[model samples]
Target: MEETLHWQPAATHTELLAGPVAEAVRALADDDVHVAAIDPGLADTAAFCEKYGVALDESANCVIVAGKRGGEVRYAACMVLATMRADVNGVIRKRLDVRKSSFAPMAEAVELTGMEYGGITPLGLPADWPILVDSNVASHNRVVIGSGVRRSKLAVSGALLAGLKGAEVLDLATGA
Candidate 1:
């Protein structure tokens, strides 16, 4: 866990999390998963890392992407280290079997995931959404990620995240 934030069992700090995130944490019941409060104003990845003295590689970002084919839409979440970028147009598009893919619109992402923009995490996404985790992120011992709210973050092992339902570990990222 990052030293700048006070870490505690995520199961014990549901109040700091968004509704779906809290529910997910309780359901997970994993003691190793932790949470920490932070300044909501610094929720964006770069700002959060710089203000808290955490390295970009020690944090992960969850991105919502929408793929469309034949007028139908498929949505997925891609998890990648902050130092990398999800290959939405290539990897994700092919994975979703869609003709094209791109980052989901902020309004649609927030509404669909029931999370705030800049603070959405894969933990509490819609059950139907596939979670694509970058290989580098899935190999980390611990990484900070959103708690579905701008005011807090979750600390979890990559193994735990990889074990999540609908999670698929793959080469989903490109160099930043």
Candidate 2:
């Protein structure tokens, strides 16, 4: 892994990670993934990339969605490149087999995932929730994704993300 003075190292031995981030790091132990603390104010994709000298194309964004079928609610985490947007209504709704689907409310998403609104990631999500990764994201050699906290980020191989439990790579993104 590349070393940088700007980032603190993360591993099983480190316990500085936030709630959901710590769990994600532990869950991805077998993969060559790394996590680093970042300034919370710059955690958003555009700001993070610009401030860190990272390319927007190399970073992915995760969105939480709530789908309703009958009276029950189902959730899914959708990941796409920073350059694109997730097709929630067209792709996700059909795949989820739900009559209605939309972005989950911030409070509900944070409460359910145990992560901040801007930092909700696919990792450590509820086992029942599927993680839909865009095909472009899955094809990359490496990607920068949320660490389940606005204060940190995770770097991992696209294959590692594809191997995540409940992950399904599809054409989930569309040009904004």
Candidate 2: Cα lDDT at 13 = 30
lDDT of each: 0.93, 0.81
Instruction: Report the poorest 10 consecutive residues by lDDT, candidate 1.
Output: 1-10
Q: Show where candidate 2 strays beyond 4 Å.
A: 1-9, 13-16
> Highest lDDT among the candidates is held by which one?
1
Each prediction's number of clashing residue pairs: 0, 0
- Tens digits of per-residue lDDT for model 1 on 99-123? 9899999999999999999899999
Predicted model with the maximum TM-score: 1
| Model 1 stretches with alpha carbons more than 4 Å out | 1-3
